[model samples]
Target: MVTRIEWLDAGLELLATEGAPAITIERLTDQLGVTKGSYYHHFGSAGGFKAALMEYFEAQFTTRLIDTIDAENAKPRAKLEHLLRLVLADPDNAALEIAVRAWALQDPDVRATQERVDAARTAYLKELCRGVGADVDPDRYAQLLYLILIGAEQVLPPIGRAELREIYNLTLRLID
Candidate 1:
């Protein structure tokens, strides 16, 4: 049987595969091998489904990371390293982020949600910087770090796992 989580998961896969423009009740129903009734029962409308997808994205990537970092018993540097490793390990997650960013350029609601996610991510990174006794301006450092991470996904060749782990370690050292 279809569930809310299943719908969101399917939406994410559809978003990654076809971009936001492909998100429709009919399309989702086809993707899930279900009917319109299931979609309507879960989401009320296509707009509601999109809204839910945005919320799910924010919760999965931003809120969960922040919670993990805040609750980590490791040292600040270790926590930062762990965060970097977790993010860099997931290439598919990076692709979804890029897809959402592309969609945001056209949709106001999506742009708003993307803005919130960026702000939250930067704030979390800044907090991590402070925790690590960074002498640099935490806010600025956070922006630079986040920009590097996002920019790498956009412009650089895909990094190997070892290379990514090295970079993560080096970044933590630089911040510390």
Candidate 2:
């Protein structure tokens, strides 16, 4: 039986490859090697699936990551470095982020979810800045960090992971 989490993961994969328009039941069932019956068994309806998918996206990509980082007992600088490494580790994750942001442009639900994610991410960055004892305003530093990331993801071809990692490392040097 395909669990809800598996369905959500398949939805995200389809989303990354084809954006939101390709997330129909037929497509998802095809991708998951399952029947429409399985989808309905897990999600009840399309709207239900969409709602759960957004929540799952936020939880999987944002909140849960933050929680995992917080579980570490490392110093602020170490935590900051760790966060950068984890977020930039996977190229596919960047593709998903870009796809979701693009989806947000045309869908109100996606827009709301994206807004919430951005706000949460920025807030966490600010908190990390404060912890790092940033010389500049925490808000400014946080927004700058996030802006750099969002901009990096949106650029033509996007910044390669190595270059983006180095850019973040340079920013990290400024933290101390």
Which candidate leads in TM-score?
2
Q: Write down the lDDT that model 1 would get.
A: 0.83
The list of candidate 2 runs beyond 4 A from truth reads: none
Candidate 2 to truth, TM: 0.96
1-176 per-residue lDDT for model 1 (tens digits):
79999999999988988898888888888889998898889889878998999999999989998797778788777877778877876778877888999999999999999999999998888877777776777778778779877776676575555776676667656665
lDDT of 2 by residue, 16-118 (tens): 9998899999999988898999998888999889889999999998998899899999877787778888888888898889889998999899899999999
Model 1 residue 17 lDDT score: 81
Off by over 4 Å in 1: 156-162
- Model 1 TM: 0.92
